[model samples]
Target: MPKIIYVDPDGTRHVVDAPDGTSLMQAAVANGVEGVLGECGGSAMCATCHVYVDPADGGRLPELGADEDEMLDSTASPRTTASRLSCQLTASEDLDGLVVRLPEEQI
Candidate 1:
């Protein structure tokens, strides 16, 4: 299992063990973490699951796919270098302890 630390907009932290091979969004949704609507499930069509990855783990994640890259451009919040769609980030042993900061909004 991968340990994911989700930081909410209000600075609340929710730590949960995510099953390897599932997406970060799936783990968050399963845990009922607020702010991650994940309307498109694990697809890259929605920006509802956008999250800002901790800079420390930034290099460990895979680069965004073309579809996800385009969708992220339409996010309500400003996209940073570390911005990513949680649904696009599949959990793995290598992603253990991944920390993601939730955006101010998920629309």
Candidate 2:
């Protein structure tokens, strides 16, 4: 299992175990990490799981697919180069210590 750190807007952090092959949204939802609504259930159809990957780890993730790219524009927070939908992030040993920062709001 890989460990992912979800940092909320208030600067609080929730570290959770992310089983390999599961999406980041699934890991967060399963662990009850606050702020990651995942309303689309890891479908990449909603921006509710919007987060900013730590710049250091951004290059390690796969490029966003079309669905996630489109939905990111609809997030409550400002879109950024680091912005990504958790639904599109799969947990793997390569992402063992990934850190993602949650936006102030999601809708």
Candidate 3:
């Protein structure tokens, strides 16, 4: 299992075990991490699972897809180059120890 670190807006950290092939949003929601709503149930339709990937680990993520790219524009927080829909990020060996910062608001 890969490990993901979710950092809340207040800087609190929640580390959770992410099974291979599971979306980051799923892992966060299953583990009760704050600040990640995952309201769309891992679908890219909702931006509620938005998170800012740690720049240091940015290279390990998959390229942004069209649907996710468009939805990011609708995030409650300002979008950054690091912004990504956690629903689109799957856990894998390459993503072990990945860290993402949750936005202040999801709605």
Candidate 4:
């Protein structure tokens, strides 16, 4: 299991053990981590699962795919270089300490 660290807008951190192959959004929603609504159920059609990979992760995450890049443009919160659609990244042993920060809101 990969230990994902989810930091909410107000700085609350929820450490979750995510199963391999599980999407970050799916794990967060299943764990009741606040700030990740995942309204589209891991689809890139909505920005509800928007999250920012901590820059400190240092390229541990794979580059975002086209669909993820496109939907992020619709996020309710301003997107930064770190912005990513949580559904796009699969958890695995290589990403054991991945940290993602949640925005104040999501559209």
Candidate 3 all-Cα RMSD: 0.8
Q: Report the Cα lDDT for residue 38, model 4.
A: 88
lDDT of 2 by residue, 47-80 (tens): 9999999778888899889988999989999999
- TM values, all candidates: 0.95, 0.96, 0.96, 0.95
* Preferred candidate (TM-score higher): 1 or 3: 3
lDDT of 3 by residue, 1-107 (tens): 89999999888999999999999999999999968898889779889999999787888999999999999999999899999999999999899988899999999
RMSD (Cα, Å) for all candidates, in order, is 0.9, 0.8, 0.8, 1.0
- 16-98: candidate 4 lDDT, tens digit per residue: 99999999999999999968988878879999999998787848888878898899999999999999989888999999988
Query: How many clashing pairs in candidate 4?
Result: 0
C-alpha lDDT score of every prediction, in listed order: 0.90, 0.91, 0.93, 0.90
Which portions of model 1 miss their true places by more than 4 Å? Answer: none
- Backbone N/Cα/C clashes per model: 0, 0, 0, 0
Find the candidate with the highest TM-score and give its number.
3
Task: List candidate 2 segments past 4 Å from native.
Answer: none
lDDT score, candidate 4, position 85: 88
Model 3 misplaced regions, further than 4 Å? none
| Model 1: colliding residue pairs | none
How well does model 4 score by local distance difference test? 0.90
